[model samples]
Target: MNEFLAAGLVTALVAGFLGGGHCIGMCGGIVSALTFALPPSRRHPARIASLMLMYNLGRISSYTLAGTLVGGLGQLLVSNLQEVARILSWLAVIMLILMACYLGRWWQGLIRVEALGQHLWRYLEPLGRRLMPVTHPGQALLIGLIWGWLPCGLVYSMLILALSSGSALQGALLLLVFGLGTLPTLLLTGALARQVTSFFRQPLWRQASALLLLAFAFWQAMPLLGFARELPF
Candidate 1:
């Protein structure tokens, strides 16, 4: 049970760190836009923090719904709970590696392969834009949920991880934690807007974050690589 909790927490942090990179790259604009949306009178840190939390709550709620649906389907595929759990464990390892590569920029090499998804995103892009002129916290929250499904390898990788949970509830909870982990970084970006975005874009930070993610990936996967049998868990 401890191991499972550890995996969930590690997965959440890694998901946030890795996904945060892409968030900086792509969704950074959203953060910036959100900052401007607020009236100056309501721009106090406390108020901003409350709005950020609400936004995250909405985003994480979407993740939970998605995970529950997928995990439910996964449960139906197996008669043995043990087998499902084993599958989830291995899938988490795989996601860890993929997210590591993604953060490292190594996964960019596969862009040619992923180009097909672009066509789908092209259609979805305009739909998201239609939600523009967001006037309320609820609007921003709902928009984030719609945008959550936006095609990106990072999100797809996490979705794969979510699917591995074997049970709907577990999958939902895992994704919620993952979303929560991402919340702070994103909230800061929203608050600071362009400055934070620029800071994250610094080559040094990117490289450092990438390396950190890679190290965590290995840490998460090492135990599963038959090393525990030779050493101690």
Candidate 2:
């Protein structure tokens, strides 16, 4: 596998698990609203599950759109091998550091970077609000697409990983996978937020996940450091 691809996949899974803590803070109410939007006649377990799945589908679609855009951008930088890989490797290192910060409780400042996406999100906001009083699964799904534009540091980090992919399809898939990874927590916000949040807060788990991410970052950068290079499968 490409080192960049590996890093991106790892990022998606980690972000999915850890990134959700922030979702509960920012989007918990959205999840609740989505649930309530379901028809009371079929408010049983299956209907709720369907709504959750649709929300995730919409969210993942947004990630895919983002990945395609960034991945295409990456190709523009591909002509200079050393330069492009150097930047990408550095990006991986930065991602590791940010992950460490989130885990170590030392630097909460990373969240502020999400503001960079707020400009685009501002445009999407009105559309999302229009979908309010979500009465059908399709409306809920559309709302998720708009909601996917929500400013989030974790999503941005994953976007960086996608940009590092060096190919449009790969980059898009990377983001899609990352978005899918977060599905469990985001989908369950109404039911499992408390439990998942508590468990994720464990110091040991956070630290371990951080270290794992740091190691992956180092590995991804190894090619630029002369430690490795792309090899045939």
Candidate 3:
């Protein structure tokens, strides 16, 4: 990938990592439901891991699909490469700032943005509900497929970033990488799940993650600010 694409991918990755808190808040109940829904006999580590893996893969696939659609739209609407680059650059920084606000719970204005998605989510949610008590990995996977459309500001932010990519393939890759970045946090299960989720949920941790993202937002804006995108050190 070119540096532009590389940077966007990296940004997506970091955003996903930082979104661990949001993920838990958004999907923790569903995850817990899936866990408890399992038969006691199937609660072994190996089984849980497989189920979570399948579910996440399904979720990531949905994200990739959204990226492809949005990126294609961007391509059709924008006919200039330089224009795409500018859009990508500006959007990366803007999304980062918004993300920082989200991570810290400083501003919930993003919740308003979720309204745009609620219409689609209502249609998808029932399908997911039907898959409840995920008795099998397949059920978990199916539920994930449907739940991926859950109205989430973080996911939507990443979609906006994907919109700036202006290439369907790159947009898909961006979301794919983002999904991977979230894997570490979302994969948490058993005792580790509580410990890690608790850590990410703490005010200190959230604030720290938000601050880091803010620094990153400024770093992304360096070029636009008339400074070298890469400091010579």
Candidate 4:
């Protein structure tokens, strides 16, 4: 793969990892609740792992679908207005920087951005409620699909990058990697909620992740300035 695409994938992964705090605040409760929803007899480690895996698969699947739709729109924009596509790519970098700031606790403007999705989430939340007390993996998966639509600034920031990708497949892959990146923290949340939360909550780690993300955003934006062509493998 070209370096540009590779960079994008890596950026997505890092963004997801850096956004662990946001995930914990947003989905941690639901994750714990889902675990409790499991039958008493199914609370063993193996069973819990299997169910959490299903839930994440469903969540990531939704992200991929969203990426495809937005990426297809990006493809059309690239075909019709190359300049506009370039502008959006720059916008994506700016959004990434803002994401880093948010992660670093430097600014909270992104939380306001999350309000943009609340109306839509209001509609989808009821559907999720109907799937309550997830009894089986299938039910967990369905609930997860619904939960994925929850309003989250971090997810919205990544969606901007996906939209700027200018290709459906690339956008899907980007989001898939991002989703995988989040797997480690979210997967462990059910079993080690306190430890995972505490680790991500550390200021040093958050600052480091945010700085790395800022560097990535700069790298992504550099090509637009004609400093380097998309590296050919």
Among these predicted structures, which one has the highest lDDT? 4
Ranking by TM-score: 4, 3, 2, 1
RMSD (Å) per prediction: 3.7, 2.9, 2.3, 1.7
Candidate closest to the true structure, highest TM-score: 4
Whole-model lDDT, candidate 2?
A: 0.73
Q: For residues 110-215, could you state the per-residue lDDT of candidate 3 as single tens digits? A: 8888788989988999888887778788988888888778898888878877787778887888888888888888888422768877888799989988998788
| TM-scores of the models, in the order given | 0.79, 0.85, 0.91, 0.94
Tens digits of per-residue lDDT for model 1, 1-233: 44554565566666776567577666666666666667778667765665566656766787678777876766675545557756766776666666666666767643452465677768766866787665577767776776665556655555566666556776677677777777767888877776777777776776777777666656666666765422223
True-vs-predicted CA distance for residue 64, candidate 1, Å: 1.9
| Each model's total of backbone clashes | 0, 0, 0, 0
| Candidate 3 ranges beyond 4 A from true positions | 80-88, 189-191, 231-233
* Model 2 lDDT per residue over 1-233, tens place: 76557656766776666656565656777888776766788677767677677777887898899888988887677755647856875785687678667655667877778788888989998998888877667877898888888987777777777777777888888888888777777777755656766766677766776666566566666766778644344
Clash pairs of candidate 4? none
Q: Which pairs clash inside model 2?
A: none
Superior by lDDT: candidate 1 or candidate 2: 2
lDDT of 1 at 93: 65
Alpha-carbon shift of residue 6 in model 2 (angstroms): 3.3
Q: Residue 26 in model 3: shift from native, Å?
A: 1.0
Which runs of model 1 end up more than 4 angstroms from their true locations? 38-51, 80-91, 110-127, 229-233
